[model samples]
Target: MSKVVLITGASSGIGKSIAVFLVQKGYKVYGTSRSPKNIENYPFELIALNVLEIATIEKAIDFIIAKEGKLDVLVNNAGMGITGPVEDTPTVEMKAVFNTNFFGAIDVMKMVLPQMRKQKSGFIINVTSIAAYMGLPYRGLYSASKGALELVTEATSMEVKKFGIQVVAIAPGDFATNIAAGRYHTPVFENSAYKENYQLNLDVMDAHVDSGMHPDEMAKAVYSIINVTKPKIHYKVGDFMQKFSIVLKRVLPDRVYEKLLMNHYKM
Candidate 1:
């Protein structure tokens, strides 16, 4: 039987791209949106699942299990982005982003694990960000949320490996997606100390996404990871420099790396 796959946040962007690609590859794909309705022309089915809502998560997982008998893979890709100076960004907003990007993904995994455990075979792919490897100016909260998920991915992999469930994280650099529209942007208050710098980085961030790699590249990476016999705990998909930044963080002096990031963002 073809693999049964469920991808969260699949209405558009990277999630949608992965869903479409997997469908073409002959997997039974079920993509999700918070409100899936009246959408069409897709080979895979779209279900209702909001990572922030436990009921929706449970419903979606149960629906897939009831129909497919067993879910073979889950792409935990439903996440929101936030960008603002850490001090100026509302504490509540930071918590909300973490709730979605971090706790929300964990909730979905928790709901899906029992079923996978019973089957003794499954793959869980947590969609993270290359930004997770290092904190970036104006995008610190976004980085922290995804970074937290990356750690959880590692711990979960070791915890579940004995049960035949494979868990891994795939961190992608900027990709051409509608993520910018969904992100919560703290306004560039005229009087705020970070106003000018924040505005500059906002433009920089948008430009990066506008010119970033196509989502198809990430889809292909996910497909490859799915087919591997023993996938690594973490994988990154991005341009040479984006991926290399992680390595630089490891080898470069703390202040040196800080200077590089500051210069990159023109801080």
Candidate 2:
């Protein structure tokens, strides 16, 4: 039987790309959107879901189980981005991003893990970002949320490794997607001194995303991770320089790395 796969936030961006690519490659793919009326007519099945809502998450999982009989893979690709100076970002706004990006992903993993444990085999890949590892100006909240997911993936993998369930985090750099449209810019940042720099940073990020790597590359990475007998705990997918930057951060002095990051973003 073809492997059964479920991906959240599959309405657009990288999530949508993964769903389409997987289905073409013959995986039984189910993609999700929060609203029933807002989904595109995709080749794979669609499930309505709101990652922040536990009930909806459970329902989506149950629906998959009932239809597929078993779940083999889950890609927690559902997430939102918030951009602004952290100082001006409201507590509520920060929480809102975490609710969707981190907590919501955790809920899906918690819901799916039980069945994965029972079957003694499954793969859970959380779609994180390169920003999770680096400190990006104006995108601090987005970075922190994904960073939280990365740690969870690492810790959870250690716990579930004995059960034959693999948990992995795939951190992608900027990709050509519609993520910018959905990103929340902190409203409170308007009066801050950092406003000018914040706008410049936002503009830079937008340009990078507009001309970034294709989502198809991410789909291929996901496909490979699923097929592996022993998948890695983390996979960094993107430009060589972005991937190399992670290494540079590790080997370079803290002082030097900080300067490089500032220079890279023109901060």
Candidate 3:
């Protein structure tokens, strides 16, 4: 029998790419969206699930288990993006992004673990971001949110290993997707200290997304991870420089790396 998979935030972008690829590969895949009903003619079933809502998460999981008898893989991909200067961004907005990207991912993992534990075998892949590796200017909160998920992925992997559940994270660099359209961008305040530079970085950010690697590359990475019997705790999918940045961070001094990022963003 084919493996059953559940992927959150599958209505578009990387999640959608992964879901469609898996379906073509013979996996029974279910993708989730906040308003799945509105989406039409999707290759796989689109279920109603909003990461911010615990009740919806529970219901989606239950419905999947009831139908499939087991959920073999979970792609915890649901998330939101927030962009702004850390100081100028509202604290509430910061909390909100963390709520969806960090707490929300954790909640889905929590809900699925019991079932995964019962099965004695499962895989959980958290879709993080390359930005998670280092704090980027004007996107600090988004970085923090994904970075937290990366750490949690590490801890959860070790904790659940004995139960035959493997948890890991895949951080992707800028992927050509509609993420920029959905991201919550705090306005570049006219009177704020970061206005000019923030505006500049925002433009650069969107341009990167516009020219990003195809989402299919991320899908291929996810597919490879799923097939591994002893997958690594972390995986990264991106262009050479994007992947190399993580290495540079490890080798470079604090201020040196900070300067590199500042130069890249022209801050």
> Is 2 or 3 the stronger prediction by lDDT?
3
TM-score of each: 0.99, 0.96, 0.99
Could you tally the backbone clashes for each prediction?
A: 0, 0, 0
lDDT tens readout by residue for model 1, 70-189: 999999999999999998999999999999999999999999999999999999999999999999999999999999999999999999999999999999999999999999999898
Top-lDDT structure, candidate number: 1
Clashing pairs in 2: none
Better of 1 and 3 by lDDT: 1
lDDT of 3 by residue, 112-192 (tens): 999999999999999999999999888889999999999999999999999999999999999999999999999999999
Which residue runs of candidate 3 sit more than 4 Å off their true CA positions? none
Better of 1 and 2 by TM-score: 1
Model 2 — TM-score against the truth?
0.96
Taking the tens digit of each residue's C-alpha lDDT, what string does model 2 give over 1-267? Answer: 999999999888899899999999999999989985544578888889999888999999999999888999999999998988888888899999999999999999999999999899999999999989977778888989999999999999999999998999999998999999999887545568887777788888899999999999999999999988877888999999999999998999988998998887777
Model 1 stretches with alpha carbons more than 4 Å out: none
